[model samples]
Target chain A: LAKTTQPISMDSYEGQEVNITCSHNNIATNDYITWYQQFPSQGPRFIIQGYKTKVTNEVASLFIPADRKSSTLSLPRVSLSDTAVYYCLVVGMDTGRRALTFGSGTRLQVQP
Target chain B: EAGVAQSPRYKIIEKRQSVAFWCNPISGHATLYWYQQILGQGPKLLIQFQNNGVVDDSQLPKDRFSAERLKGVDSTLKIQPAKLEDSAVYLCASSSRDRAQNIQYFGAGTRLSVL
Candidate 1:
C-alpha cells in the first residue's frame, strides 16, 4: 500500500489561496490520488481526484507532477467555512482488494 | 434523491458489550462502504459491498467486528464484545458502479464511544 504524508496543520487567512501538498513517494502506477475535506463530526467529503497533471473542479484543483510522487490540492479564495481537515489519499485495492487505507490528514485552519 | 441514511447517530458502550450500526445507501447505488474514523485521522475503510456481495473486508477486525449487506440495499455493522479501542465514528458511504468517476456519497456517520 502507498502511504501519504502531509503537514499536521496549516494556518491561512480567508480569501487566500490555500495549497496543501501530500507526498506519496512510493505511489504505484495503478493508484489514484484523491483529496477529501472533512468538517467536525461529519464524514469526509470528496473534493477531487486525479491520475496525473492538473484536474480542476468547482471546489478545488489537483496538481500531480510527472514523478507521481506528490500531489497538491488547491482551494481558491478560501473562507472561514473551509476550516477543516483535508486528507490526501492514494486509492489502491488491498491484497484482498477490500478497504481503503486512510492516513493521518492535514488540518487546515482558515482565520479571518 | 435521498442521501445515504444511518441510524443511531451516537452510541456509547463499555468493553465486552455488543453494538450494531445500520445504514441505508442511496436509492440506486450498488456499492456501499463502511469506514472507521478515529479522531485526528482520516476515515479507514473497514469493508466494501458491491450490491449484496462482499467485495472487500480485509481490514475488518473479525475477532469482534462483522458487517453484512442483505437485499443489496440496507446494511448492518456489528461489534461483539466491544473494546475501548473500538471508539470511533462509523461512516457509511455509497457510489455508483461506473468505473470512472466513482464519487462516494457519505452519511453523517455514527459516533461510538466505548468506555
Candidate 2:
C-alpha cells in the first residue's frame, strides 16, 4: 500500500474553491488516486478519482501531475454542508482483491 | 438501489464481553469491506470480502476477531472478550462491479463502546 500524507485541517469560505493536496511519493504504476468525503456520523463517500492528469465530476476535480508523487482535490464553490474529512487513497486498479488503506484525512471547514 | 446496512447502531458492553455486528451490502455488490474508525483517526480496514470468500484480512486480529460472508450478500463481524480500546465505530461498505471507477457506498456504521 502507498503511504499518503495530507494536511490535518483547512479552513475555507463558502463559494470559494478549495484545494486539498495529498502526497504519495511511493505510489506504484498500478495505483490510482481516489478521494472520499466523509461527514460526521456517516460513511465516507467517493468524490473523485484519477490515474493521471485531471478528472472532473459534478462534485469535484482531481489533478495528478506527471510524477504521480502528489495529487490535488479541487472543490468548486464550497458550501457549509461541504465541511467534512477528505481522505486520499492510493490503491491498485484491481478491484477484486483490493482493500482501501485510509490515511489521516484533511478536515475541511467551510465557514460562511 | 439500497445502500449498505449495518445492524445494532450502537452497542455498549463490559470488557471481556462479546459483540457482533451485521452488514447487508448493496443487492449486487460483490465486494464488501469492514473498517474500524477510532475518534480523531481515519478508518482502518479490518477485513474485505469478495462474494463468499475472504479477499483480505491482514489487519483483522484473527485471534479475537472473526468475520464471515456466508451467502456472499450479508456478513457478520464478531469480537470476543472485547476490550476498552475496541470502542469505536465499525463501518461496512460495498462497491459495484467496476472496482476501479466504482465508488464505495457506506452504512451509518455501528458504534461500539467496550468498558
Tens-digit lDDT string for candidate 2 (B1-115): 7788999899999999999999999999999989999998888889888898887897899989999999889999999979999999999998875354567788999999998
Candidate 1 residue pairs in clash (backbone atoms < 3 Å): A98-B56
| Clash number for each model | 1, 0
Runs off by more than 4 Å, candidate 1: A93-99, B98-101
After superposition, candidate 2 runs with Cα above 4 Å error: A92-99, B98-100
Candidate 2 residue-wise lDDT, A1-112, digit = tens: 5467899999999999999999876666766788999998888888888999999999999999999889999999999999999998775323343545676899999999
lDDT of 1 by residue, A1-112 (tens): 5466899999999999999999877666676788888888787789999999999999999999999889999999999999999987676444534235555898999999
